[model samples]
Target: MTTKHLNLKFSVKDTDAIRNMAKSGRTAYAIALWFIRQGRPVATDEVLRVCDDMGVKVRKSA
Candidate 1:
């Protein structure tokens, strides 16, 4: 069996765009998934903060 992992990378421009989207009321999950689709790593803290500021409640899974 063989396993491979994705190497996520992002540029300054990408971060800026993500931040803009976050500020514009985009959901954290949506934004994070967007970066994942592009093979980029999203900053979790930033996303969580944005969600908090925008009153996006994150549900806990059991």
Candidate 2:
């Protein structure tokens, strides 16, 4: 089996857009996961901050 990995990188504008989406009721994790599936995983801290700023609660995984 073989695996491929891609470094997730986003510009300031992209981060702003993601934050805006979070403010519009989008789940931070969902946004992060979307990027991840596209081979661009976002930082967990960044996502969590967005969720917090937007007053969204992220359920902890068991």
Candidate 3:
């Protein structure tokens, strides 16, 4: 599958790609958007910072 980036550097985890469309659960996109809404979604590290700051842990792909 091809994902069109929003000019955002951070890459969402493969696992959270689909399940993150909503806010009911924690996912990469959801977490990233949370930062974008805060006016800080330009770099990959920044995106990761948002999730880390929020204590949302992304699972590692095997």
Candidate 4:
């Protein structure tokens, strides 16, 4: 199996968009669309921050 990876940095506007999507309860959709549009992944930490802002609990893997 081959795993493809990319290193990406988010712009100010992109960060703002993530937060806005989180606030509007559409974080997943926003992130997915961004990936489809840019062919890159958003920062995982940015996603976690959005969850934090929404008070969503994230559990670690065992």
- lDDT of model 3, residue 53: 44
Query: Following a full C-alpha superposition, what root-mean-square deviation does model 1 have from the true structure?
Result: 10.9
For 1-62, candidate 1 gives per-residue lDDT tens digits of 11132223434565456567766666667777777787866666545654454445432211
- In candidate 3, how many Å is residue 21 off? 14
lDDT of 2 by residue, 1-62 (tens): 11132213555565566667665666666777767887876766667655455455553221
Best by TM-score: 2
Judge candidate 2 at residue 28 and give its lDDT. 62
lDDT (Cα, tens digit) per residue for candidate 3, span 1-62: 23333424444552244234323454454555665776855444544444444455653221
C-alpha lDDT values of all predictions: 0.54, 0.58, 0.44, 0.51
Candidate 4 overall Cα lDDT vs. reference?
Answer: 0.51
- CA deviation > 4 Å runs, candidate 4: 1-8, 28-33, 43-46, 49-62
- In order of appearance, the predictions have TM-scores of 0.46, 0.50, 0.31, 0.44
> How many clashes (backbone N, Cα, C below 3 Å) per candidate?
0, 0, 0, 0
* Total clashes in model 2, counting residue pairs 3 or more apart in sequence or in different chains: 0
For model 3 the TM-score comes to 0.31
Evaluated against the true structure, the overall lDDT of model 1 is 0.54
